[model samples]
Structures are given as structure tokens and as C-alpha cells.
Target: MTDQPEPGGRPDAPRLTTREAAELLGVKPETVYAYVSRGQLGSVRAAGGRGSTFDADEVRALARRSGRREPSPAGGDLVFRTGGDLVFRTGITLIEQDRYYFRGVDATELARNHSYEEVAEWLWTGELRPGVRFTAPSETLAAARRTVGALPAHSGSTDRLRVAVTAAAATDPLRFDLSPGAVLSSARSLIPTLVGALPVLGPTEADGGSLARGLWPRLTARPADAPALAVLDAALALLIDHDLAASTLAARVAASARAHPYAVVSAGLGVLEGPLHGAASGLAHRMLQEAVDRGSAVPVVADHLRTGRPVPGLGHRLYRGEDPRARTLFALLEDVPQAAGALAAAREVVATTARHAPLHANIDLALAVLSVSCGMAAEAGETVFAVSRTAGWIAHALEEYGERPLRIRPSGQYTGPRPAQPLPHAP
Candidate 1:
């Protein structure tokens, strides 16, 4: 056998063995032969003519050309998998060991003591500053209120919020500024404006205090107590960020295009309105209400299970055992006297579902329980989720703004027929 040239070839224009060529090109030896067959890469006869060798220059050239092609998965989807494992990376929030952490801080722990405003500041600035206030200007709140009031009386909370955000953006003179400081300011203002603009049942004692207190009257006619307020605060803190959820991804994609913060939020709200996303909580609320009214969860849960449809708020795709958010919020519910029926229904539903399959109550179930117990509207759970998740959407938008613009663009695989020749144009 002829001796092979050194790796990277000799200074005198060396030849590479087929194996060496394949290694350099990150392909199998068979692929190297295929390239030779296609005339894309050249091969030379060995000294004894028993095996083939590749010219070093030709292999390197082919490698360079291959690197220029866009990287994509087979069948032209962005779906990436290895060994039947699907993976994506984000430095924001992590779901692991049946718990969630935001930038290394335990989310449940944060929810225990922190308010939603403090959590939002933490997620946005990577610092847990206590007593952080998210305040909207008086004029901005007035504009949002005007816009929301103009909507039809039957508009859902999410619809009113969507239009309110647009109106607030239109009124802000600094909205076009995309600087980090400006964006953060806008996010802080936007959250408060969105919550404050909602129609309330009665006057709130502390209108500008905690976010939960401000939002209480809007969600329910019942008065806000410390325990109920704590549950709402904790729910908001826990739901502040959850890795890159679909709505957050949509917000990030919009931010990647340099869209204004309002536009980014609008994009997120658009996706959150879907049934499978943020609206799942509303369905869960209705299901919980049925059990509460009937005084038994077995019949409701059993009927849903028999249909082969997933029981809303019972299972989660990420957590294996109990969802930590649900556990935290439900634990708080024990102190809420009004939530007795809803809490009982939730427990029974969880117990019954676990017997049939490995399912546990998730955050939606907790939100539903909170809503029903507190006399909130049937769709109040979705409102909580949307309002809470807006913090995460803003955090993601800020993160995306710092990345390479338009990096989220995905190429589509054309599956259409070949193009036909155009007919001659009339003179």
C-alpha cells in the first residue's frame, strides 16, 4: 500500500487518503466516493491501484462549499433532535428537577416573598430589587382607560387589553426609542397601564399599591384580603417567566425585527389568545366551576377522561410530578375561606386524575380555583395568565433586541411543483 500524505497535506500539494478526506469533510468514506462520482470532488489512483486517494485542495474546496449551504434539519424543518431527545437553549428560565428557576433563582422561592413588580425587575435586570414599583404615567393610564372603555361592553379582558396597549403606544412620544433603558421604561409603564385600564367592579382601597391589589377589583367583586392578594402575587411571580413559551417566542421574533415594545407585546397577546396557550386557563376555570357547583369532581373529571381528551389543568408537558406553581398557589388557598369549595374540587380532581394516569394539577387549575373562590369572572384565569406573562414577554423582547437582528427568521422548504415556462407576452 502507498504511504498516505500527512494531515493537511504536505507543502508540495499532497494527496489525502479517502478516509482522511472523509474526516476532513465531516462525512463518511462512502460520501467521499459519492462526491467523486458526482464530479464535485476529484480522486486519484493509489500507487498499487487498489484504493483511491483525494487531492487535498479538492477536498478542502468541497468542504468550504458545503459549509456555505444553510444549516437545516432533514425535510427542511427547524426541528432538532438527537437520540429521540428534543432540545432548545435559553439563558432565561430553566425547567428541571420538577421545578423552575429564573436565571438560577428558584421561581417558587421568589414567588414566596417577592411581588410581581419586583420579579419583573429581577427578570429584566437580573437583580432582585425589593420595593420596585412599576408605575404608569397618569396621562398614559387615562389614554388606556379611554381606549378600553371605547370597546364593546362584551369584549373579553384580553381584547380590551390588546386595544389599550395600542392606544397607550400611540400616545407615548418615546415609544419609537429602542434603547435598553427606554424599552425597560416602556415595559414598566405598559404593565401598569394595561392592568389599571381594566374595568373594575368597585373602588379599590390601594389603587397604586401592589399589582395584585390594583388588579383585584378588576378581576373580582369580592374584597381583596392579604391571603387572596398573596395568592395573586405569588401566581404573578411564578408565571413571570417560563423559558421560551410560544407567546414569548412570538414576542422575541417581533423584537428581533426591531419592532417597538408595544408591537412586541401585541404580537405576544395575539398568540396568547389561542386556546392551546394562555386561553387554556379559561377552560380550566370553567371545568373547575362545574365541579364546584356540583360539589363533586369525580363526575366531571371522569367524563373528560372517558372522551380521551386531555383534562385541562391536570397535566403539564414539562413537569413530571406536580407543577410547582400549582402546589405553591394551592397551598396558599388553604388560608382562603371563600375558596373552600374550589379547593376541595381541585383536590378531588387531582386525586382522581392521578389514579387513571400520571397527571397532576398545573398552574391553570390553581388559577381557576383562585378565580372561582374569589368570585372572579369565568375568564378571569386567562386574564391573570396574560397579565402575568406580559412581564416574561417583555424580558424576552429585551433579550432578543441585544441579539443579531432577524436571527429568528426560519426558511421554508418549498414543496410545490416545478415552475412552468411563461407564455409569450402580447405585443
Candidate 2:
């Protein structure tokens, strides 16, 4: 019934019978049916008959297939293709999305209604109805604490997290197993470990909250946020997860290869450590700070774009519209009271750049400006990015656990002649 003739198009799309199509394409009638099932062609049932009819255009299109492709260079470009459907997914914190779906629950609503503990529990296990703040069995809190506590009290949170996670995985039996239960347990354990080690609230410190404040004795100058505990809680809640990203992809790749939590998570963090990705916001913020400090953000903003370097933090790759995370943080910024100047500079920066490039302040840029203006460290922003992406990494790792143990197989084009010529060597 889809055969509405293209206005003045080929004679009513000549309803060639399957047998006729086979003749036209130089194949058997069964081969014509094979093409239809393989999605290589289309067909419609003949009017008032059991036989299917083929549009002449589709038949001709099939006839044109020469089974040849462009000669692409040997190392194929990396691409993402949905591999297959999965049954179970687990233990991922999500990014600072406006509509963050944490394990299946809506994060924006949860961010407003539930506590971080509530969300963390939900992320670990699907039970959303709140009860106790505790996570599931084989609870690794004491073990994680002991491992981190052994480090010198002066260690930075990032350093501590790295060491702690590495140490925790060494003893965890689940890291070697590709089982979902084990991976899930490791994910649950690592979350607390990372959060526990962040820097204490204090001056010269960009990140501090109750979690951080608890470790303040390590820093020479501790900041005084009267409700230190609240900040930590907020940090836990604020950073948790995000969508699939390059770093997340790296993590997933490692997991798909059956790497342990430490190895897999490290793979992701290593990618995120790249300046072009995770460090983007902090770099942008610092760039803006230099401009502002020199009383030249306006001029620099204009000149930078002209010189080929677009203003950092104002544009995004996917969000052609305003970045939702930026909008949410903008709302959060309204209440911070002390971020007025940075907010003003950011506003001017955003307006100035829009005249040239299609960029919006993504989460990193927004968080950078707000955090810096609110007296956070420049490095703290990227650290938070790592924490947020951890959510998605775990989720992806869990998804991979159910699939066949795979080392991504690809066909390499034969470019080098069978074997290299033997060279005569005089030793």
C-alpha cells in the first residue's frame, strides 16, 4: 500500500514480481526474497495475491550493487556501534545532568528530593524505596578506610583515591572474575573510597566538604565552612555520574577486555586526564581568570577566537542548545552569594563568544567559573569530572559483563606483501 506513485515518477513503480526481479537482477526468485529479508531491498505484496511485488526502483538499486568499496587505508578509524542488547546493568553514578537518570531513577527529581546516600544505594541496587543508608553485603567500608588511612596524612585526595582503589582491587577476588555480582561489588566499594579521600575544606584548597573537611588536618590552612558536613554531602550528591563520554568509553573498553576495577577505572581516568577532555573546564577557568586578572577578558575573549583558539568552556560538541548542566549550575550559582563577579565575567564571556562560535558553557565550564568564584581550587574541577564519570564507567562495565569474553576482533586489510624480504646482515 506504500506504492503511491511518485508524482510523474517511473510508471507506477513497475510491480515486478519476485521472479521478474530475480531475472532483472540476474538471480533466482529465492535470492530476491533473501535480499528482502536481509534489508538489502524492499517489497510489497502483489494486489489480490500471495506473491510479493517489488518496486522497479528497488530492483534497479539492487542491480547497481557491485560489491566493491572505496580503498580506505589500513588502520581503520575508531567508531562506535551498538553491539547488542544487554539484560542487566549496574553500579554507575551519573554526570551532573539536568535530567540525570541514575540507574533508571530520574536524578533531577532525586537531587531535589532524596539524599546522596539514597541515590548511591539506588545506584548499587535497583531498590528505590528508601530505607537504610547502607549499601549491600560484603560491605567494604572498613577495608577501604584502612587502606586509605595507611597513606601519609599529607597525601592529596586524588593521589589517595588512586592508591586506595589500586590497593582495594589487589585484594578483591572479584576483579579477575567477569561476573556481574563481583563487578557490582567492586563498583560499590570504590565509590566510597574516592569520596573519602578528597581534600579537606581549607584555603589553598579548591575542594572541601564534610568528606573533605574530615581530612583537613592534612592541609596547612583549613577553610571554615561552618556547616562542613553539608558541603561533603553536597559533593557526594553533586558529583555522581554522567552520560557516555570518551573517558567512559575508555573505561568500557577496558572492562570489555575483562580488566579489573582498578585497571578499567584507571584506563578511563587516564583518558580523562587529557587536557582536551577532562581538564578543559579548569583550563578554561584559568584562562578566563588570567584575562579577568589582567582586566582584559573582554579583549582576550574577542582576540582568542580570531586567532583560532575558541574561548574555552562556552561551547559544547553535542548540546547545540544551551547546556542543561550549565543551566542547572546557573540556578545553583544564584544562591552561592559570593560568585557574583565570576558570574558577571562568565555572562560577558558567553555573550562575547556567541557572536562567533556556536558554543554554550558545558558543565565543566560552568562548574569551573562558579567553583573558582566561590573560592574553589582550579584543579578541583577536573577531579570532580573524574568522580562524575565514574558513575557511567561502572554502568558500562556492568553492561559488558554479560557479553561473550571478547577481544575486539577486526579484519585487517592486507597491505604489506606476504612477508618482508630477508635482509643480509653482517654481524
Candidate 3:
């Protein structure tokens, strides 16, 4: 069989050193030798037979099958994996050395320098339109608002957003146009529509305003100061994409089946409701709020441990150090005078939790600080995440639509009872 060509379309790729192969496979060098011995891997003798070199593609394949590979350091390969065994080659986002990039540019830098709409446009297309703005069409916005208004009075923001997506899809005559241009159009509109459907808490901004400005009124009654708006916009851009998150994987799966851009977003929103994925910020918000209310983080931290709940917002599995998103947002939050009390509570919680295990604050905790300080509801972060991540879902859909249809369907490794056992009679 012909070897699948490398990512650059090269047939003769360079081999990997034993140490490099071991790093990719997440095993020790000795384990690499063991795999070679068991015929599970192939290696070539180095110049004097003093070392071994393995096929680069073979090592990567084993990493995928075993579903384990350590996060590469900065200056390493752009690709990294987490969340599951299935892997898709993507050019969208890369996280390495605790920093993430969008389309190969530093994401945090993009957030700092550009607007959310501008960064999202660059993610979908390589070109950056410096002053790009996304506006929801009146018809689509109307449809979404009608659907959202019909929801039960106590519906959370995510629930309303999900329902709004369906409504927006129905209003769009071209939603099934999955071509690149058409998908980008849908994405540009859908994001703003999702933001628009939420009930406004104060005087509304023009629908054509910057997305962060448009979103501010929906999230809270308090008027947004410039610093607070800066934090919100940065949060939106920072969250535009994280490679192959659970929601993003769901979006890719739908796109693999040729689902329209709206349907793809719906699939992602479906997965976003889970506590582990999107609700995490809401949990962190409540914790920070409690700590602020009680004037100390000690009892709040103790309460979580006493009740068998891990302290929220303290750790992230992906980052061994402080979460970069958290670090960036915390730095920005320092400029917001009103954020002082909640920001202090967040730092106290981190210091308190570090006594037992040294865990760094994740994005959820930073979002919690923003929400608690700004007087936004507990779920405001979720709303921000869902809206920002719609751009990522569309980016993934564009990639998936280019591949062979249904290519993402993985075969099940069935472990159930053997087939055709005698049927049991009714009990």
C-alpha cells in the first residue's frame, strides 16, 4: 500500500528519532523498543546502529489509536490533541506551551489588537478585515427573538440561544448552501442573531454596533464602561476557538453528515449544556460570589471540600501552569476599578486551594470574576462562550465539508456480549 503523503504532500517524509517517537507516542524510549519488538511499531537502525529512527507517520498513527500524547512545547509541531481519540487535521487553532493560536497568529494578541468580529473573520478566512462588524438581518433577528420570547420564563441563556438558532435556521432560505461563501455568510449573521435574541437588560445598542457592545446590554442592566467592554470583547475573541472541544467535535460530526451551517451550530450548542463543557463558568461564578459575600474564601473553599465537591475554577487539565486565557483576562480586569472586590476573591480562592494541591486558575475562574464583578448573572459567561464559539463551529464545519462525506464516522469497538447468543424467553 502506498504511504499516505505527509501534510505538505511530501511522499518521503523525514524519519523520527527514538526519543521523538517516544514523545509522540507518550511512552518512554524503552517502551518504544518494546513496541518495535512486538511488531507494533517499526524502526530503522541509525548510521552506526547506535540509535533507532522510526517513521513519523507511524508514530502519529499510534498516538491517535492509543489516544494519548503529551502536549507539545512551544516551537514543536502545531498540532495537539485532547478530549478524545478521534483526530482531524485542522488549520484553525493550535494550543501548545499553554498558549493558543488562531490561524497561526497568537490568539491573545489578536484579542488585544482586534475586535471580536475581526478575529472571527480571520479565523474563517485568512484575510483580516480590521474594522469588520457583524449585523443580524432584521428578518432572522425577528424570528430568533420570537422563538426566544416563547421560551419558559425561567429559561437559561443557553436554552434561549439554542432555540434561537433553530428559529434563525428556519428563516434563512439559503441555510443549505454549504459552499464556503454561503457558510461564511451564515456564520457572520448567526453569531449576532444569537446575541440579539437574548432579552435586553438596559437601553439597547444599535444592532450594527460591535458585538461586545451589542452583547453587553443583553447580559446585564449596568451600563458597560470602556474597560469592562474591553474585557468582554477580549473574552469573546479569546473563546473564538479551542481545537476540537466537545461542542466543536459535535459541530464537526454534524458537518460531516453535510448538515447546514445552522444545523452544525445547533449540534455544538446541544453539547454546550453539559456541566463539564460550558456550565463550568456558572459554577465558578457562584463560588466567587459566595466568597465575596462571606468576606473570605476559606469557608467557601472548605465547604466545597467538606461536601465532596472540588473547588471550582482552580484547575485546568490542559494547562500545567496558569491558563493563558485566565492570565490575559486577569491582567485586563486589573484595569476595571469595579472588578477589585471580585478579583480579590478569585485570587484568594486560588491561594486557598493551593494549600493542598497547586492548581492554577482556568478560563472559567476568570470569567467568573468578570461576571461577578460586572453584576451579570451566573450564566453570563455561558452566553458569551456560546456566542463566541459559534464562529469556531462554523470554521470546523468548513473544514469538515471539504473532506469526504461521513469521513468522521468511527467504527465502534464493541465490547458487548458476543453476537447471536440464544434469545432468552420472557421472564
Q: Considering summed lDDT, which 10 consecutive residues are worst modelled in model 3?
A: 1-10
- Compose the digit string of candidate 2's lDDT tens values, residues 237-267: 5555565567776776787678776788888
| Rank ordering of all candidates by lDDT, starting from the highest | 3, 1, 2
Pairs that collide in candidate 3 are: none
Query: How high a TM-score does candidate 2 get?
Result: 0.64
How high is the lDDT of residue 277 in model 1?
87
- Among all windows of 10 consecutive residues in model 2, the one with the lowest summed lDDT is 78-87
Give the CA lDDT, 0 to 100, for residue 157 in model 3.
94
> Could you give the C-alpha RMSD of every candidate to the true structure, in order shown?
6.5, 10.9, 7.4
User: Model 2 off-target regions past 4 Å?
Assistant: 1-107, 129-160, 177-181, 198-239, 291-296, 410-420, 423-427
**TM per candidate:** 0.82, 0.64, 0.82
- Which digits, one per residue and each the tens of the lDDT, describe model 1 over residues 75-127? 23222333333333456898898999988899999899889999888888898
RMSD of candidate 3 to the true fold? 7.4
**Against the true structure, candidate 1 has what lDDT?**
0.83
Ranking of predictions according to TM-score = 1, 3, 2
Select the stronger candidate by lDDT from 1 and 2.
Answer: 1
168 in model 3: Cα distance from truth in Å? Answer: 0.7
